[model samples]
Target: MSEPTTGPAGAAFDDFVAARSTALWRSAFLLTGDRHKAEDLLQAALVKTWRRWDRIGHGSSRSHETAEAYVRRALATTYTDWWRRRWRGELPTGELPERAGDVDEAARAEVRHDVLTALAALPRGQRAVLVLRYFDDLTEQQTADALGVSVGTVKSQASRAMTALRSSPALTDRFGDAA
Candidate 1:
């Protein structure tokens, strides 16, 4: 009997991570809208992907794509689960929280922040759709697969998300007539 080979698979996993980690992290950050949360989200997704790496990495022509799809799916599902769980424990308070730090109006980063803020205001599924579709450039079917939803769901979410962003005063100001 032949022993199972771990060396090539491990190397392939490593290569996949090295090539795709940054892009995946960026998607996680867009989904989370917070750097700390993004890091945690990405780490969780990576751990889940690593656990299933061998199975995902051994396919035919689509092995690399399969691995990426698995990781992306993990990120989307984990973020949705985390958001639900986090909100479940929050106590509703009548008092308004402290304001965030003042932003410099002249800085482009502030405008970018405004766009992100608008993005964060979206529902979790819509936000995931935007990230998977626009940020990661996944096709509608791919986005649907990643989120474990039907293609119709992906279309509706993307449409609603775009409408929300376009109507958002913050984003409208950032993009002006372009929005």
Candidate 2:
């Protein structure tokens, strides 16, 4: 389709981006496990979505859902493509410092760090599967659709992901002794 021009379609795309970019960024961050990469991933998805705005079921009764599905698919596929290309190479420096907030906030940040670190160890497909299935709360079919895989693939990926997470020493140590 032709690119969305600087008119009604462009305006609609702008409004959608303004309203949904933050949530999309969170999802991208979960998929990528990095702030800078997540920003780039979301930006690339937005650009692709803008290019296809007119044909993306814009302003339909379920416009929000349709647009999100399109952009999310772009995010997932592009992330996988990047993995195949080995675009990112550097390892994370360390767990981020907890923000100077309440005690509870500090604990939550630590837990989040542990979880994300553990997630980063899994293979790219398994990580994507878990993020889509559990984090995004998508159904098996929906997750499969988003990742461009079959339902069986989704199930297997989720099963393997959970097994890997269960065996992660860092994750177990973080919450294992708490209970």
Candidate 3:
């Protein structure tokens, strides 16, 4: 990983990342549904935010909040752009990987797999809205802002995404009526 930038802007940026990286990583993971992709997404977003740290008013009381919003926006836009230009050369196989020894871990992995499968089926916009509004716990307006969409668009996308997920075979098979 690259070293943190020096001086005031660097200090602020470093502090923001240190304090919020875990939560940000969760958002990224939910958005990408893959650990390596999530790490790349978060790193890309953080780099974008770092480039504008001074302009984002690093010394202000609300600097961290501003930086958070900027980073989230970056994450959403970058993911969408990547989706648009995605290379589909790689294909998934039907074979399942070996299970973990721990029963609890295996159950958690199953749930995660089901959820990721369901999420992967969503349209890019709907997936982004769902991740931002639900997983990241952002309000509809905040999600809209992050996505550069209107609040109504966020609401509709979220609703449609939820409806699709509720009907998804991956989730339905796992959770039955609850899904």
Candidate 4:
């Protein structure tokens, strides 16, 4: 699709992306647990949001807020859609392809991997809830709005996700005595 690059709509869209893409990318990475998948997810959500930009941009004085919410909601729904379709084009292996050069970096990478592995084990709804509520620092109401779920669902999912994370072997194996 052709994007508007010269008009007010184009400027606003570009500005929004520039301002928020990094934060949005972090949310996407937390959601997907993989860098490439997160990039794909963010791109797809942005494209979807861009398609509706005219309507989103023209209707309100709070157009920026509206556009942000729309983009966030799009990201959440698109992720859910992709999960439901079960698109598993890549498989996890038992070993890292390359070792970290430094011991400190290796330790950090291991911790990050374990955390990601634990997060990846969660059901999509719970994972999404945790990512939105904790990782993205969104409120329960905001998370619910983004996920198209009720506030209660968000709370319950967050509770369950935390419980699951606490018990996940990927985490407990590394930090068993600390908890």
Candidate 5:
């Protein structure tokens, strides 16, 4: 991803960043299962969205200046493109040594890690569907629009992704045992 250059339209971009970057980064971590990778993903998505802010933020109605939709769309597109091209293996979400000091911190970290690993194991398109539908609490049509796919695709992706997760050993051990 390229660096963010300066421009007059940057105010809207800046507003978006100030409002949403942290939550987006958190969602990114869940989607990516890596803090560093999530940061990179957030920066890349932000840059891409900022580049198009003018057209998106043009003097139009509220629906036209949809920053959330734009960012989500950029993230889904970037992630799907990268996964298609690279097909990277799942990132391990096992607790890192960095979490050793505090018990409460470690437990929270562990849970986040397991969930992320479980989620990231899905195909990128499916993972995007999951993140948008569940993590972002978006509707099927919202996810479909964000991913540039169809509502049927979103449904199938979520169903397939959930089936895969339920059968996954990590998820079974971490969450299924409670069922």
Candidate 6:
């Protein structure tokens, strides 16, 4: 397929967006589990990226990997920020409370719902750390850089999250099967 050409800045930006937009939006949606929120998060990240496009391009990396790193980090932090606003109550949900639990693939869907709920219930820092460490496969230092926190913070967050997840019956049931 022929590529769309605009200008140096516009074309470069457009190409970057076109190539990465779908994956980034999907990642955002998976992280947030809300379509509207995902759209807002991705848009915000892209806008910030566009503002820094010139400076970012001036860096040494030709692959735009640094830009991708920035976008992922921004989106992750934004999701965590939005999640905190929704955590006003102190109630605990052991099983899945999701309304979208109905699925033709009942067994797996049940496990997935529980996992999502568990992830959502985790403290913002812990959840972000877990997702960065396990889901995104980023190292502690990378996760710390992404969240603008220290590596020690990442380690502590992961330690706490792992402890809680291990104590969680839902996760034990789900993950035990994997092991």
The C-alpha RMSD in Å for every predicted model, in order, reads 5.3, 2.0, 3.0, 2.8, 3.6, 5.8
User: What would the TM-scores of all predictions be?
Assistant: 0.83, 0.91, 0.91, 0.88, 0.82, 0.74
Clashing pairs in 1: none
Error of 3 at 56 (Å): 0.8
What clash count does candidate 2 reach?
0
> In candidate 3, what are the lDDT values of residues 73-94, reduced to their tens digit?
9999999888789996875544
Candidate 3 or 6, higher TM-score? Answer: 3
Q: Where does candidate 6 stray beyond 4 Å?
A: 1-6, 58-63, 83-104, 173-179
Q: Which run of 10 residues does model 5 get worst, by summed lDDT?
A: 56-65
Query: In order, what lDDT does every prediction score?
Result: 0.84, 0.87, 0.87, 0.86, 0.76, 0.75
Please give the lDDT score at residue 16 for candidate 6. Answer: 81
lDDT per residue (tens digit) for residues 65-167 in model 6: 7778888888887777766677566854455344465565666668777777777767877877887777777888888999899999999999998788776
lDDT of 1 by residue, 1-179 (tens): 23224687777777777888899999999998877789999899988887877667553548878988999999999999998888545543232233356345336566667888799789999999999999999999999999999999999999999999999988888678678
- Model 3 segments beyond 4 Å from truth? 1-4, 92-101
Q: After TM-score superposition, what is the CA distance of residue 115 in candidate 6 from its true location, in Å?
A: 0.9
Give the count of colliding residue pairs in each prediction.
Answer: 0, 0, 0, 0, 0, 0
Q: Write the per-residue lDDT of candidate 5 for residues 1-179, one digit (tens) a residue.
A: 33345664565567667878988997787777777978988889887776767666633346233877888888778876767788556644443665546899877767766776677677877888888999999999999999888999999999999888888777788778551
Worst-scoring 10-residue span by lDDT in model 2: 87-96
lDDT of 2 by residue, 80-147 (tens): 99889984677647666766667888888888888988899999999988988898888999889999
Model 4 residue 31 CA deviation (Å) reads: 1.2
lDDT of 6 at 43: 97
lDDT string, candidate 4, 1-179, tens digits: 55565688888888888878998999889888878989999999999988878778743458877877887888888998988898567877665344647777778888888998999999989999999899888899999999999999999999999999999999989999463
Candidate 4 lDDT (Cα, 0 to 1): 0.86
